[model samples]
Target: MNVSIIKYNAGNVQSVLFALERIGINAVVTDNIDKLQTADKVIFPGVGEASSAMKYLKEKKLDEVIINLKQPVLGICLGMQLMCRFSEEGETNCLGIFDNNVKLFSADLKNTKVPQIGWNTIYDLKTNLYKNIIENEYMYFVHSYFAEISENTIAKTNYGLEYSSSLQKNNFYATQFHPEKSSDAGQKILENFIKI
Candidate 1:
């Protein structure tokens, strides 16, 4: 099967590529429209600032191409944030695949950090993406902004308060955490996505 990883000005593309390789899937990393449209599955992975990433996608016109894809699409980290309607990070408008909006974690929280980096448990599993994955399984996360729990939220996580860690709307699936870096459970989630 042809799996294409959307390449942009974002970080962590190589790590997602390698993660797919370990799962025995040889995927292409490209911004080419044809390559993306023809893939059996598309992975949109990002680890970067919101506005800049949105700028690059719009500049390449990939912003339009991504929303129109018929095949299953998986978005990671900032990719997930970009899929939302808007982001608080830079007051940027996003692709709007999901109805929810991304917001910055409050700095006024007593002890927790803004960007919740490191392992966190994901529960309330609600999509095929979490098939076979147990509740409260640890997943690696690194983000300052988060999507509020909405009708599209498929999984939930709590740092200071609860938020959508993963979301699904139609064929689009997204994770605020980096599954590629989450270890065995993460691999399973990726494999499950390939199967879908």
Candidate 2:
């Protein structure tokens, strides 16, 4: 399969590449529009600020490329955040593949961390992304902002409050948690994505 990881100024591309390699899939990391467009599966993973990343996508015209892809596309973390309609981070507009807004974790929530790092259970799983995964499976997460529960939400997780941990709309899929870093279950999720 021609698996390609979208290359940009974001962090964690190498980790995603390594994870795919571990699964026996040698994914190409590239910003080339043709490679991305023609890949059987595309992984859009990012670990960075929203405004800057959006700026980069606009400059490279990747935003349009990603939106127009017909094959399955997987977005992780900030990539998922960027897929939403808007983000509270930097008050930026996003790709709008999913009609939802990303918001910052409110500080008023007691005994909860800003960037809900580490393992957290994801339930209400729906869609092929969770094929062999069960409800309440722990997934690694590290983010200060989160996408709200909407019609597209496929899986839900709770930290300070309930939110959409995973979402699917047409050919696009996304996860707020870092499946590449989530151990066995994480690998399973990646494997499922590849199969899709």
Candidate 3:
């Protein structure tokens, strides 16, 4: 399959590439609309500012291309935030693929930390992406923003409060965590997506 990792100003592009390499899928990383739109699968993995990233996508008209894709598409971390209707990170409007709102984690999480970094266990598994992902499986995460639990949410995780860990709507799928760095469980999720 021709997997294209949408490249923009966001960070973590290389690690996504490496993750695909580990799975034996040589993916093309590009900002080109034609290449991205034509790819069998597209992964919008991000790790940076939402305002600037959305600007870049809009500037190149890649945002529309992403929303119109037919094949299975996945978003990781900031990628998931961009798929939402709006994000508090930069008070920005996103792709609106998923109707949930993204909000910043409170610094005062009782005993929890802001950004919700490190390993997190995901439960309430739904969709083919988690076909083999056992309930309560641990997935790596790193973010200050999170998606609100909603009808689109397929999985949930608890940090300070419970939040949507993974969401799905038709061909669209997103995760607030970084599966590329989540080791075996993460790989299984990616592998499930490939088959989907």
Candidate 4:
């Protein structure tokens, strides 16, 4: 499969590429519009601030390319947040493939951190993305903002409160967690996505 990883100023591209390699898939990292449009599967992974990421996408016209893709697209972390209608992180408007909005974890929540780092279980799974994956399986996460639970939420996770850990709408799928760094279950999720 011709898998392309969308390249931007964001972090985590190398790790995602390595993870795909572990699954025996070689993925190309590029900002080339034509190459991205022609890929069989596209992975949009990021670890960065929202407003800046959106600015880069807009400059490259990748925001338009992403929203119009006909092939299966997988977005991770900040990539997932960018797919939403809006994000509190940067008071930014996003790709709007999913109707929900992203918000920051409340500081008032006792004993909870803003950026919920480390492993967390994801439940209420849906779609082919979770094939052979169990309920409440642990996935690695490192983020302060989260997408709210909405009609498109395929999987949910609880840190400060229950929120969307994964979402799916037609050809697009996203994970708030870093499946690349989540170990075995994560690899299984990647394998499943490839099969889809």
Candidate 5:
């Protein structure tokens, strides 16, 4: 299907590659502009800090390329954070695909841990990304920073507070949780994305 995974200075690309392999899709991981532009779909996956990741994207001019892709694009975790207007992490500016900001979780939450690791339920599902998935489906998450609920939020999750766990606008789709690590529900999300 000519699916392409955006290659950059970020973690999680290998795991994403393996996830796609599990689905029997042989996808290419590349930073080449042509490969990205011509792919049937593009997966922008990341597990890293926002500012540095944006720096690498800018250096490679991938930020521009990613913003212009007409084909459906999915951003996972940090990749989704970078797709927003700005990030509280290092106060970095981002791609502005989704008109929202990434903010750090409140430190005053006595009972909740920062990063909110492990499984969490995602509800308020919208978009094809969760086609066959039901409400309150648990997805793997590992992050302290989160995208705030906005007009673009397709799904919401709660930890210290409610936040946008998934977002969509036009061709861009994103998940704050790691669908690649979320088991069957995660696999369904990935399969839906591939279909898109």
Candidate 6:
């Protein structure tokens, strides 16, 4: 299958491409909207500031292309954050594919740390993305901002409090964690996404 890893100021694209390569899948990485929209599957992976990333997508008109994509589109980390309607990180408007606002961890949770790093178990799972996945299974995560628990929450994870870890709304599916970096369980999650 033809897979495209979106290229708009990348940080994790190489790792994601490497992950796909390990699974024997060749993926194209590009910012060209036509290629992105026509690909069999589009993987939106990011590891950078949200506002800057959105700026780049908007420049390429990918901001609109991404929302209109019909195939299963997966967003990882910052990519997932960008899929939300708005983000507190830069008080910026986002793609609005997920219909929620992204917020920074409250300063009150100082004990919990700002950018939540490392593995955390995800529970209250609700999507087929969890087909072979079990409840409270640990996955990789490295993010400071998070999508608040909302209607589309398909999974939950803890930082200072329970928050949305994965979201699903129509053709848009996203995860706050980086499955490519999560070892075996992570691979299974990506496999599930590929099948979807």
Model 6 over residues 1-196: C-alpha lDDT tens digits? 8899888984588899988888888999988878988898999999999899999888888888998999999999999999999999888899988888899888698478767889999999887888889899999999889999899999999888889999999878999999999998898888888888
- lDDT value for model 6: 0.90
Candidate 1: regions farther than 4 A off: none
What TM-scores do the predictions have? 0.98, 0.99, 0.97, 0.99, 0.98, 0.96
- Candidate 5, superposed: residue stretches over 4 Å from native: none
lDDT tens readout by residue for model 3, 1-196:
8999998889698888898899999999998888988898999999999999999999989889999998889999999999999999889999999999999989888787886779989999998899978999999999999999999999999988999999999999999888899999898888888888
lDDT of 2 at 145: 98
Which regions of candidate 2 fall more than 4 Å away from where they truly are?
A: none
Off by over 4 Å in 6: none
**lDDT score at residue 114, model 1, on the 0-100 scale:** 74
Models, CA RMSD each: 0.7, 0.6, 0.9, 0.7, 0.8, 1.1
In model 4, the runs with Cα more than 4 Å from the true position are none
lDDT of each: 0.95, 0.95, 0.91, 0.95, 0.94, 0.90
In lDDT terms, how accurate is model 1?
0.95
Report residue 70 deviation for candidate 1 (angstroms): 0.5
Per-residue lDDT tens digits of candidate 5, residues 29-107? 9999999999999999998899999999999999999999999999999999999999999899999999999999887
Off by over 4 Å in 3: none
lDDT of 1 by residue, 72-124 (tens): 99999999999999999889999999999899999887678978999999999
